[model samples]
Target chain A: MPGIDECLLEAMKLPGARGAAVVDWTSGLALGTAGESQSGDHEATAAETAELARIAAEYQSFAPADGSDWSDDDTPVEDLIVSSRDSYHVLQFVRTTFDSSVFLYLWLGRTEGNLALARIRLREMARQLVLG
Target chain B: MLHRLAAEKATGSLMRERGTLYLSDGQVIHAESPDTPGLDVLLTAGGALSPEQWGEALTEAGPQQLVGRFLVDRGHFPEGALELCHLGALYDAAFFVLGRGGGPARFRYGVAHWMGAVRPVPVDAVQRETSRRREMLNEIWPEDDTDTQPLVQTGLGLDTGLPRRQRAVAELVDGVRTAADISRALGRPAFHTLVDVRRLAAAGIVTAARRPPRAANAPTRLPETSAAPDVSLLRRIKNALEAL
Candidate 1:
């Protein structure tokens, strides 16, 4: 039942978690953000991550083989993880009652963060994100 | 006027012909427009909240200007849901309000929306997103008339391979409904529906119902009983709602 701010605060507690945000991919708007962003600005980070989310969600090639035709329902891609030299970016998609176009982003340092655990927890958070 | 208000950290509503933008401490808290779907429509139309519940919420919490908090606290819906819808509705209306020059923008101080503030967006962010949306629509199809004029589905629609979302919008084009009408029917944001409409127009699946140009001596304003929304009256209604 955690709202956006509470959710982001929870995300920051993860080991080596630098920052987190909830973003609407369609509009490239960040609904909420917490902690420090390596990109210096949270808005800029939102737009960049939205681009990645849009690519994974929009393209047919990114969908699974046996999945139903991509319509307005939840996208087949569950989560996206990008590894840079020193950090990890994880985006977990949330299925809203109205529109399933939002995702939670977590920025983690490569050394202290557990990618597997972070991914699992993010999925849980996304599920707990009540839409209506 | 909007930028100046932001600079001065003013809190109130900015009234324009297209809509109203509510800013809290110089940041946008909410927006509403007659031509765009509101949060109530998005909620009830999307089936996320029943009309009865919305009515009850209004009766119980609207007077206190805590409908948003009340709904969340009552467990009728989550805060994120309300906030997200509010954000979408704001941007949808702000698109029409921004970058237009037909009428003047009047600012009133110390006023707040009854829906309450969920998030405060900077004026620059709102402006940036507005322009970005305009560019996106232009990139898909560079025409403004399709946004306001009645839309018609061409015979080419049956054969056109359109995406599912766009298909739904195209199917609603009866040569009578405008983009705003289609948007409210679909329970989606007007801007998103406009994107689909513009794409449909570009793909030849839909077109704006064309009309003959008026004579040079014709008045710029439409005749009485026009379909166009009444901005002044709408603004008064908005003010009355806030007062109540």
Candidate 2:
């Protein structure tokens, strides 16, 4: 498994990737960051993404209503993708035995980035990302 | 002091009453404290490894100073899992270890932690991270006194807005346990618990016990020592005046 910096570098290798960060949603702190942030300030961007992650993970409506009990798994939201006029942002949650409140944030150029590929790659990276 | 050590590229264990910080080539590789649960507890408490397996690995590789490597080589746990748990425990203990002020500290040259170095973080990076954690907590709740005080769940309506981890923490709060105690009981990182406790306080869902009165009554500042009269001379003059 790749460590935090390596994992971030791997994320940044995605086509048209502008920036990548591993953020702890609970504290709104960036554990690691690579490349240029969309907002220019990585800290502010981390906090902003954390707020969105918190909202998505906490709201009851986001919980899966399928017959299977959703409470068994801690993940309330799998991945969140935001598309803007010029860029795309992806947040992929990592499930762990401990509090699963961290997410990988990736920013990509709308024109050159493949949203589908980035999203798929992010999910895979989130699985193998070693936080230590 | 850590900067000086780092400058010299020191390799040793800095031991204090609160905990010990192990450094290799000036980088902090491991830390352990009684205030926070260690990697052993984190792994076994979560049922990732049985006690027997942990004991076997320790017994086999402890003398060789390859306990961590042995565990990983034996497939007891993935290297990533071990590193994560080790890092978590290291930082958790380091917070308290570094926070301890004016304590007797001793450094033993060439001493290394038994688990060995999983990932070495620069001394400056560790210090920056520690301060960042403090700032994060302050942002959530301005009061620093709540960090050590026993937690008391308030009757405020704010409890409903708590996140899942905070709710779990609130449920464990019995009005007697401090954040550190709750963290140990819940098998969570002490720093994470502190953050949640601060957030709970900020939300008015919980309150910390009032700080106790300090024993020292000394003034915050005093005049320059060179300008101040000698203490014995002043005492003698006062005694002479009283006798007169």
Candidate 3:
């Protein structure tokens, strides 16, 4: 599996891929971060974004109208996208048997980044991530 | 034992059945689980990166060094904020990792991290707080399987005595909107909304199904914990479990 450094380097190769972080959403911690000249606080942004994702995911699971349909095991998150005029915030939770509660967070300049490509890169990075 | 390990300021990896979660100085930094979507999903879901980018990144270079270095070198997040984000992510991930049942969890010490510069402020308070909230969530919902399951509300009964947030959420869910959609619709900060959700679930205004613990699953024919306790709440819980 790819180590933290290798993953960040790979992410930067993406078009307009501004910044990336391996954030532990469970505790809102940034495991590793990369890229340059960020616009805001990377760690806080990561924590906040993770918070948003968790709330969004949990809310989706607990909404009232969903009582009759509680037969399944968990909810599927297609994505949690929060966009500003020039920036896009992403929080991806990577689930492996080793650590199920962590996520990898990425931030990009909306104008410079290719959203679709960035997502694919992050997914690939997650698959190769080894926690130790 | 886990708490004791943390108190020892251990530096090592905690292994779980599904995956592994890493911790430094009792602060969790890395976690991987098989049951839920990994970091890629969180990133893509937020629309920062697309599937194609993930694929290309993988093909062009390995995922390890590339993703890690990119996060630190890119963007302009302040130290305080970055620290906050890191702490939040750790706690959120821990909520799922440490709480998983039916598995053996082991912690091996003496692992040093070269990426300590990337580490943020400590997350002791935040983690403790999240754990408390998780307990409350469990008290109400009593199930770990709901993390990925589709949420359903049957337009059940309720009283006006509930908190406004709870009332609002209940009313909204009663309308058949998914919980995720409601969270987006509410547009409130996630932390506040989630606390309210926990309250609603614990109050029985919301429900999820799970097999009760042996303590709770005792048959009606079995002797009770106390035959005539003056407490009414205990009686109520006992009644509920008996019905199950």
| TM-score top scorer | 1
Candidate 2: stretches off by over 4 Å: A1-6, A28-52, A59-74, A130-132, B100-104, B214-244
Q: Which window of 10 residues has the lowest lDDT sum in candidate 1 chain A?
A: A66-75
Candidates ranked, most accurate by lDDT first: 1, 2, 3
Ordered by DockQ, highest first, the candidates read: 1, 2, 3
Give the candidate number with the greatest DockQ: 1
B166-188 per-residue lDDT for model 3 (tens digits): 56656665434444444445432
* TM accuracy, model 2: 0.81
**How good is the docking of model 3, by CAPRI class?**
incorrect
- Full-model lDDT for every candidate: 0.81, 0.76, 0.52
> How far in Å is the alpha carbon of A88 misplaced in model 3?
34
Per-residue accuracy of model 1 over A1-132 as CA lDDT, tens digit each? 677888889889999899999998766778789998888999889978988987787566776776424333555788999999999999998876664368999999999999999999988787676643
Which ranges in model 1 have alpha carbons more than 4 Å from their true place? A36-39, A64-75, B158-161, B211-244
Give the DockQ (C-alpha) for candidate 3: 0.03
In the range B48-153, model 2's lDDT, one tens digit per residue, is: 6788998897888887767888877787765655655666677778877887472877888898767777777788767766777777786666666668888887
For model 2, the interface Cα RMSD in angstroms equals: 4.4
